[model samples]
Target: MRVSMDLELKDIPGQLVLALKPVSEFKGNLISVVHHHEKKTPRGKIPVHLVFEIKPDHLDNIISLLEESGISVVSVDEKRYLEHGAVILIGHIVHTDIKDTIDKVDNTGYAEIVDLNLSMPRVNRPSSASLKIDAVSKQHMSAAIELLKSIAKEKDLLVIEPIGIN
Candidate 1:
């Protein structure tokens, strides 16, 4: 199976090596790597595009190891979702737990959070965030959205579902 990965790494020395070491350790054959040092991501990390080939069964193991090593696997899958959706959540995001929200979406296995933006004006003020979620099918996407809504309701937060395209 051919795998393409987009990674964000620190700019310091040894960071690239740290990212690539997992490929060999997991028995993945590296095809190519495109590191864009000239451009940095919004998070201030360098962006790297890499391609590799590995046995289908080893894919999940490799991904788990990468994440365990503190590398964020933004996206990984054979099927692409043609449909996309975005939603907004208003609450005390930090107190409510952002990692817990991400874990819920990731644990579902059918959908994943592709992007997130959070803002808070003050400790007492409500925080708002926009989440971009991707799924293999519309039904799965709706299910994920429903799960998010449930979480919001439980936390006493407001959830704005995707009503139209931005």
Candidate 2:
């Protein structure tokens, strides 16, 4: 598949070289790389744009490899990046570390929480949140939902699925 990737690399010598290694190792034919050496992210990393082609299955491997190597994969072509869905959670959400709960879905690499709305009536009372999640594709939605449900159960939160239909 043809894909474009946005990456963040530490702004040190040889960092771009290290970032390109994963694409090569994963058998991605390099089409081009646009590295903005003059620019730096708030975290002091350089922004790089790359275009390439590789097998669909190899895409995930390369992304994972890049992350494991301490590079941040900011975005990939939406054609394979994700599909959007929404869900709600009701219960003691804030008490359970909302960051961790969100991370559980995002860490999967196939699912992510893109937007969220939270409501807490009182400090001692329960809370509810509407979460907008994006999965790699239609096929990954169920897996993402299942993972959300599991996390809800562990966190004593209630999961409301298939949002916006009813």
Candidate 3:
């Protein structure tokens, strides 16, 4: 998995090395490190941004080691989305409660709708919607799409799923 971390270091020298030593000790593959030496946070600490790939189990240890070394971790973002897919629905999307549909997918936790484009030619005509979903893995993406299909059936909508999505 890939992780992005924002850290704050003291203004003293060798802080960057101290901050990154933990990641290396934990066997994380360093992707990039942006040390903002010229900039300082309101707390008078330098900000550093780091991107790395590491085993899921080792992430916590890396953070712990960094904190133990006096590196302040401002934020940690784990990039979990590894699969993406898009589907189209043709029906009375707005009248059928679009928000409810979106909520159902997002509540799944493993998947969520990231982008949506709606096309309503006329008020009385059937509406069309293009939805882009992101999920942690291919299985989760498939399950999310299946859930969408079931919702479309309940709303009397026509689903146009992409070929080879599975």
Local accuracy by lDDT, each model? 0.81, 0.86, 0.91
Sorted by lDDT (best first), the order is 3, 2, 1
Task: Write the number of the candidate with greater TM-score, choosing between 1 and 2.
Answer: 2
Question: Which regions of candidate 2 deviate over 4 angstroms?
Answer: 1-78, 163-166
Best by TM-score: 3
lDDT of 3 by residue, 59-135 (tens): 99999998898899999999877788899999999999999999999999889999999999998899999999998
**Cα shift from native, residue 128, model 2 (Å):** 0.7
lDDT of 2 by residue, 1-166 (tens): 5689999998778888888898898887888899997898888889999998676788888998899989999999825544678898999998899999999888998878999999999998999899998776666788889888998999899999995332
Model 3 regions more than 4 Å off: 4-62, 65-77
Decide which is better by TM-score, 1 or 3: 3
Pick the winner on lDDT between candidates 2 and 3.
Answer: 3
Candidate number of the best lDDT: 3
Candidate 2's C-alpha lDDT? 0.86
**Residue 27, candidate 3: C-alpha displacement in angstroms:** 13
Q: Which is the winner by lDDT between candidate 1 and candidate 2?
A: 2
Candidate 3 colliding pairs = none
Where is model 3 poorest over a 10-residue stretch in terms of lDDT? 79-88
